[model samples]
Target: MDNTFDKKHGHELLKKPQFFFGMLLIMSLLGYVVAKGGVVSGIGILAMPIVISYVYLIFAIPNTGIIGIYILNFVAIGIVRYVKGVPLGLTIDAQFLLIYLALFFKTFFHKIPWANAKNDLVLLAAIWYGYALVQLVNPEAASRIAWFYAMRSVSLYMLFTVPLIFILFHKKKDLELLFKIWAILSILATIKGIAQKMFGVDAFEQAWLDAGNASTHLLFGKLRVFSFYSDAGQFGAAQGHAGVVFILLALSQKRSRRLKIFYIIAGVLGLYGLMISGTRGAIAVPVMGFALYTVLQKKTKLVLMGAIMGISVLVFFKYTTIAQGNPTVRRMRTAFDPNNPSLQVRLANQRKLKSYLASRPLGGGIGSAGNWGLRFTPHTFLANTATDSWYVMIWAEQGVIGLWLHLFILFYILTKSVYMIMFKLKDEEIKGMLSPLVCGFFGIMAASYGNGVLGQMPTGLLIYSSMGYLFLGTKLEKENLAIKAKEQLELAQCNK
Candidate 1:
């Protein structure tokens, strides 16, 4: 009987390792399949079964509630592509889907101590909803489409992504990992942009541009490099934002010499990539972001000095047209030219929007105005007209009330973040890290004056995600301070 019991225990112990090995093998195979790049059809075929199994598993193991949903989104995307009879880029899509899924699962399983709705994001959401509500009352106006666009582009995407970011990214290590991924992606984009600039538009980009009916010629016949993003505008803005963040972060880090060198190289390369994108509006983003940082630091003298230099540069560019001599500079100068056809058109559109807005204060319903609106909700008011500026789009769609809410949210967030950086956060490294984020926010706000940047994919993602980080960092800083105070008090009592 003793021999039989010992044998049974040995068998059970052996089975445990086998089960572990099998699970690892399955996970490894899934990763390999994803890396190899053709899981769409397979996912589609297994979608129904996977969904059923996932639902059952979720009920059996509540911790895995989000896994099934993540899988479902990819499967749905695949099924949509299959029905449309379009050849999809499964590799890129799959990678994004996996990242999204991982974030979702992390949020579902782990309770993020820092996650809360007390920051600027909450205000932003409120503004979005307020504007959306306004649109519901007056769906017939042309500006109404802008509201619809906001719903699809800004509101929905943020709702899906920011929560995941807040939950999954709690520690400094997580932030580092995120930055690493961002750096790698930025490098890839820079290389692609350089390639496109050096060699004319490739077959892939050409096909995409043709499909989208966008102009291929950019920067005096030099092809504007878009890489994998939606347009040159987005690519430039993303690169510019990345460049500023990298530079600021590098300056802030207390790292080894080699890592510092790498950061400098990355920053320069990212800036070069931004230049190649030929997006004039993007150039302003970094400057604005940096200015915000300086202001928050209470460097009034520095701010004044920078403003003088900036004005001088603008004057030189405006009067002498020195920028016109250089291809890249010339495009940048175009943004300042009031006579430029695009600017004139945008202004004319704004005038029309203002007249429409004056009549219907509440404005049009949500999902009524821009390209996103037309795609997501076809029956809204402002769906056809191009609402170029983010602020303008908000006003046209959601009216004054919506705009106020949106502004209020941004204002609240900025105030809170600045407060944390100034008072609560004691670490120099942490303060430095937050500088760029603050600056980026300012830059986006400035750029939004000319461009409807609030709804763009990568930019929107960065802004919302950064807000989460800012909130989390503040909470962590406060907690750390409290712990330190407690320790100090205990030590003092013991000494007495």
Candidate 2:
């Protein structure tokens, strides 16, 4: 009777066979593939580990919050251009949306703090986004889909990403982490650009140039060494921005020696990248940023130094023949010459656009200008005219009303940030961190006068994140000091 019972139980267990069919299905498919193509099967077998790792990363990244989002952002800005057939870097759009969803879902599962959500900076961003929404009914708009694509960089990313930064990244270490990532990636970009300059463009990049990009990319028999950015203009301006930020951070007396060294190296590499990009307008970024920094100091010594430097640069460009032999210097010198043919052309185009858009308060629709305009409505008036500056693009799309609002918002944030840095912040390290970010924003804003770099990837992302951090400046300093005080108190108690 016991043997019978045991045999019945064993039979029941066999009936439930867990792995048999699953293993058989997998093995059968593998076997069939191996039989069909042995080497191809082996290749797929080798790729299995990588596929598994990618799957793990996809699931794990959501836990990282803003860090993961920034990592994806870096990839989007620094790597996506090299990837073929991506159609305006769709991966960036998908990843940004995915991260937003992840953060949204995480809020339900975990207790995430809403830090500085009600701040003026964040409120301004909301207004900007709402204004973008209002543009959908723009009567001049040719395609709604075009507006969807064009508006993402203009306002959507800035709208959501800024608040996310505040909520997710609260610690001082978070600021350090962002700067380090920025510096390292910029260094890598410089290296790649150096390779392009010294050797030649890679196969993918060459192919990109071949695909009608050669007209603009290859100027006067010289390549513009864009690295992996969207274009040389973007690359150069971003590099210049990085150079200015890192250089200031390097010069900060409060930073550690190792950190200072790292910043210096990053700054040098960044400047090199800027030089190779052959973008003349990039010079304005650092000059304007540093000049503002000096003024913000409110010291006579710094003021005089900054004035001298500014005057020196002007004189060098205007009067001196020094460094004119250098191709980079030569290109940049043209920026100071009002008589430059390119400058004249740009001015002429702007005048024409002004005349045409004078009567229309809303101007051309968002997608009715620039590359979007050319792609969607090639024969349109705005399509032919060049809205080279970031402000110009805003004017073309949103008209003077929107332009003034944007400017007002920028000036408000900038003034508030300067006040916080100069008066409100007490901690030196915290002040140091915020200073570079604020100054960098100013640099980018000034640079935007030359190119439509402000509303683009990486820069747009950086600007919004900087604003969030600047708004949280006092909070961050207080939290850091409290932590320090607590540690010191604990130490004293232990001694007693």
Candidate 3:
């Protein structure tokens, strides 16, 4: 056998012994716990399987590539909160570390490709990470512990995920795989949400509601229907994000009939999830997303059509009193009303925040302003006042400088994506594929103005990965065009 083949064979051969030893080690640990503690210890031993599987999955993610890890990250965030006692939510960090470990070894062995390692997006991520690190020394920071708790989602995850996606998930098929996974998950989330709406909450869900969550989740005596997500805001905005993507994907030309059908189904279900979650802020996602999508089309006729449709929807909600009897429509209608009490409250809170933060250019520090602030330093003004918007939360924690940098990073990514869609990309299919995702990102960004949902799990991951893929679209399209041109030349030469 060849040397490379023999090495690979040996690697496989070693896996069995490693597996056996792993199991033996787990059993020994369980036995020790039992010896030290008894039945209580034996009960605690149940976590061994979760730990073993979690370790196995971390190593497994590299073989599945970037999309695989994204899907795993999505699934983990979607359900980990419901899984009691295991702290499975934090295992994602382990996955991130394991990926870096694998990449390091692969590089050492000359098996890792470095060609795709450099990009403007990757550079932007590095810059963002650097800014986040500097915040550790902010003079106004109340608690370093809170920064540790909150910064993972803020800058650390972005540092690793952006480069990883650039390395592995730049292909058109990878985009399709991403769409398939996202659509399926959105549909399933809607299904679970619908069950909660029609049937009722389960034991875990009901327990959560009863344990002080009901105050926020229940509005006007109607359930918010969060489903398996972190909360109703996440569920609603995420569903709306999916709805916009799939609906636009469905409308794109040259797609297969089956794909169109799949998109339509997913889009409808996603919209339903958005409706039932009663997340009024989520309505901004589709409205703003579709507006951006139309603008990106750059066709006078399509732009006119999109404008007319958008105006009609707004007019219906603002001018007409129709459908006031329907609860869903009624709640949605409130989103447009400027004088709505909640809107007033939000504005008043912003005023208060502006007054407090006027002098602190660095703000209070990352974790000193949100839920982490409340838990770690309850007496802080930002924590008690509620930074309802993601932007507000960023402003409260990072101060003006940090918030502006974050905004500039996002704006740069979105602007670059638009520039690629408009001028650089030549393949219609590729252009069509990226347009909605970029637009959807804009929508989520807009929605985040009303809620602190963007930097949380799944949404943050989705947006970061989308940014990588959107940037990669131009590269993939150029390669595709080159191949096509070469094939045409070859055919002509053969005919001559």
- Cα lDDT tens digits, model 2, 64-130, are 5456556666556444345433343555566566656766666777776764576777788999989
In candidate 3, position 39 carries an lDDT of 58
Against the reference, the lDDT scores of all candidates come to 0.65, 0.81, 0.83
Which lDDT value does model 2 have at 301?
100
Model 2 is weakest, by summed lDDT over 10 consecutive residues, at 79-88
**Residue 341 of candidate 3: its Cα lDDT?**
93
Cα-based TM-score, every candidate:
0.72, 0.88, 0.88
Model 1: how far residue 252 lies from native, Å: 1.1
Q: How does candidate 3 fare on TM-score?
A: 0.88
Output the lDDT of residue 430, model 2. 79
- Give the runs in model 1 whose Cα sits over 4 Å from its true position: 1-127, 130-138, 141-150, 216-220, 373-381, 478-496
Q: What is the lDDT of residue 397 in candidate 2?
A: 87
